[model samples]
Target: MRVLAAMSGGVDSAVAAARMVDAGHDVTGVHLALSSNPKSFRTGARGCCTLEDSRDARRAADVLNIPFYVWDLAERFRADVVDDFVAEYAAGRTPNPCLRCNEKIKFAAVLDRALALGFDAVCTGHYARVVDGPDGRELHRAVDPEKDQSYVLGVLTAAQLAHAMFPLGDTEKTDVRVEAERRGLAVARKPDSHDICFIADGDTAGFLRGQLGEAPGEVVDTSGEVVGSHDGTYGFTIGQRKGLRIGTPAPDGRPRYVLDISPVDRTVTVGAREELAVDELVGVSPRWCGPAPDGVVECAAQFRAHGEAVPARADVSDEILTVRFSVPQEGVAPGQAIVLYDGDRVIGSATIDRTSARAASPA
Candidate 1:
């Protein structure tokens, strides 16, 4: 089998590619140049897709003695992931760029291209397992729970999973680094990238301000009384407490959290922390890993990438997925993906459209 290994200039990816080579598969390493201006993006051990990362990937491939190439997907990444992130923020929703990158770039674009070039599968360093269940190929959590990335990979379809390879899923991060060191890979000591890759300084508010210029707005209470003023509503998300800079103190003398953000009216509503609790969620654009479930099914719903999975009852009808939590959840913002799981297997995922504060009933 011919395999296309995506070397990201990181310890995990380098080890994954090495394992592919050891497996005796005809392996080719490809580094994706995601940034149009590599110098502008984050550099060094804290960033990815920069010029330094590309060189590191090439060196790793050379060490493994495999054919290497670089593919520039900057335009596609900008249009699909970066632009979508900005737009989602402008529309008062919190979006995860990593999920978009996996859905639109890695699995969709890279996999399509690899298959067209006669490659059997696209392998990556992501910490998620692909198991051949009785039904078919199923995505599962990694052996190391701390590094499981199956939440972001939930956007992949059944077909995508069929041709996907995660070579490092069964190994721990520490062990992967050790294997890389033994294989003479220099990225064995590279620091893992954190925060957003595009935002070098980690100042997301400033980055959004640059993208969507300042639109002065009023921060009002639930009763419509103005309490503060903000440069832009895009700087806030649901359940944000710090940096509110509210002039008027609450009568109860408690900190206020952002309850709602109306981008059209340029109004931000602030209230008590309890107001952020949501018991129900309506999600749009559901992506199933395999066949859609019939009737109501018991599952665990994960709101964030590393968030805890809560007991939930989910059902889909008319292409709209609705989930009812056994207990109220907090800080569930729109435009975020709610990944549903059955034990360790990923069942499906959906983009959160809206949430309700109604009382939760037993599932």
Candidate 2:
């Protein structure tokens, strides 16, 4: 079968491409140029989609003796992932750009193109397994629990899973690096990139402020009384406790956490740490990997990419999914994903629209 490996200029991707070649699959390597600036090079630990990454990917391809091409998807990336991220924040929600990239850019855009060109599959280095389940193709957690990336891929549909290949799903990250070194790949020791890539300086707040500009607003306590002022609400997320700029301590002497942000009125509400607990979360635009749900089901829910999975009962209706956790959790931000898992298999996921500690479940 012919395969197109999406090389990201990292050790993981390099090893993934090598494994595909070892298996004797007709393979070609393609690096996605996601940055708008043509000459920008990957610098520091947060570099992404820069020219350096593309060059590294090409080097790996050369070592593998495979044809390589760099595809400029910057415009598509900006519209689908980067712009969507900024828009989500502007609407008072915390969004995961990686998830968006996987759903829209990698699986949707790249996969579509690969199929159009008659490639059998789009291979990637994501640390998640694709299994031929009894029902159908299913997504599962990687063997390396610490490196499992299935949470971000919850948005992928059954069709996308059919054409997706993750060669590193069963291997640990350490082993991948070792294999890369053995194969003479220089990316074996490359430092892992950190934080959001587009925010070049790592100042998410400042970056958003530059894009959205300063829309100073009132910072209020739980009682709705103004406690301080903030330059913008886009810089804040649910359960954020630092950089709040609330000078005076609370009467109870407890630190305050951001409980909610109202972009409509440009207000940020902060409260006691306990107020961050959310017991019930409702997700919108549910996407099932295999089969769409018929009714409520018990599953483990992961709210963040690297966060712990909690026990929950989920119900799907129309496009909305309601997940009620057995215990409350902190940092349940709107616009984040609620990926549902049945054991190691990923059943489905949804985009969080609302969460509350006291809200009753409509399911």
Candidate 3:
């Protein structure tokens, strides 16, 4: 098999490429240059994409004795991931840029290019397993539950899964590091990159402020009573409680949580914590790992990458996936993905467009 390994200059990718070579498959290492400007460096995890990363990738390929190249997809990444992120925040929705990057750039751009160049698959360090099910290819949780990345990978279509390879699926992060060390890869101890790679400063609010600018708005209690004011609504999420400038407590002197945001009115609503409990969600733009299932299916739904999978049933109508949880779920923000699974196999996923919480009973 001919493979193009995506070396992210991390221990995981380094080991993955080595394993592919050990398995006797023809392998080539490719580093994605997602950053437009590689001269200046960002500190912390975001620094993983600096020119240092490219050099590290080249070293890993040299050690593995495989051909190496760097593919520059910076423009596509900016338009697809970063712009979508800012737009989602501006529209009062929380978006996952990693998921978007995989859906658009990794599987779409990189994989397509690999296939065009006569490669059978594009390998990456993502901790998710692709298995052949009764129907076709299926995405499953990695053996290392602590590092499972199936939630973000759920956006992949059946075709994408057909050409994707995750060599680290069966191993833990510690094992990968050890393997890299044994292979004499210097990046064995490199720190993992932080989420939101584009935001070098790690200031999400500050980044949004720069893009959307400050539009002062009023923060209101549940009953439409003005409580405080905020510079912008992009800084706050649906279930956020802290950083709310509102000094006054609720009538019961309990904690208040952000229940809703009206981007039209530029108003944020705060209420008791129970108000954040949601029983059902309406998801849009559902993507199935295989053929879309007909009628309803009972499956485990994951809202966050590391979040617990909850018991839920989904009914698909058109492209919308309506999910009802066995118990009320809290802190489900719009634009976040709700990935459905049957045991370990990824069934499908959809972006949350709306939610309905059951009214909390009296205390």
Residue 204, candidate 2: Cα error in Å is 1.0
Clashing pairs in 3: none
Per-candidate TM equals 0.97, 0.97, 0.97
- Number of clashing pairs, model 3? 0
> Per-residue CA lDDT of candidate 3, range 1-363, in tens?
999999988888889999999999999999999988864443453745688888889999999999999999999999999999999999999999989999999999999999999999999999999999888888999999999999999999999999999999999999989888999999999888876788876889998999999988989998999999998999899889899999677889988899998777989999988778888999999999998979899999999878999999999998889999988888999999999989998898999999996665222
**Per-residue accuracy of model 1 over 39-85 as CA lDDT, tens digit each:** 63344325586788888899999999999999999999999999999
Using lDDT as the measure, the top candidate is 1
Structure candidate 1, residue pairs in collision: none
Worst 10 residues of 1 by lDDT: 38-47
> What order do candidates take by lDDT, descending?
1, 3, 2
What is every candidate's alpha-carbon RMSD to the true fold? Answer: 1.8, 2.1, 1.5
Cα error, residue 223 of model 2, in Å, equals: 1.7
Model 1: what TM-score? 0.97
Report the C-alpha lDDT of model 2 over 1-363, residue by residue, as the tens digit: 899999988999899999999999999999998887644565543756667888899999999999999888999999999899999999999999999999999999999999999999999989999999888789999999999999999999999999899999999999999999999998999877668877666888988998999999999997888889999999899989999999768999989999999999999999987778888989998999999877899999999998989999999988889999998888899999999999999999889999877755222
**Residue 112 deviation, candidate 2, in Å?**
0.4
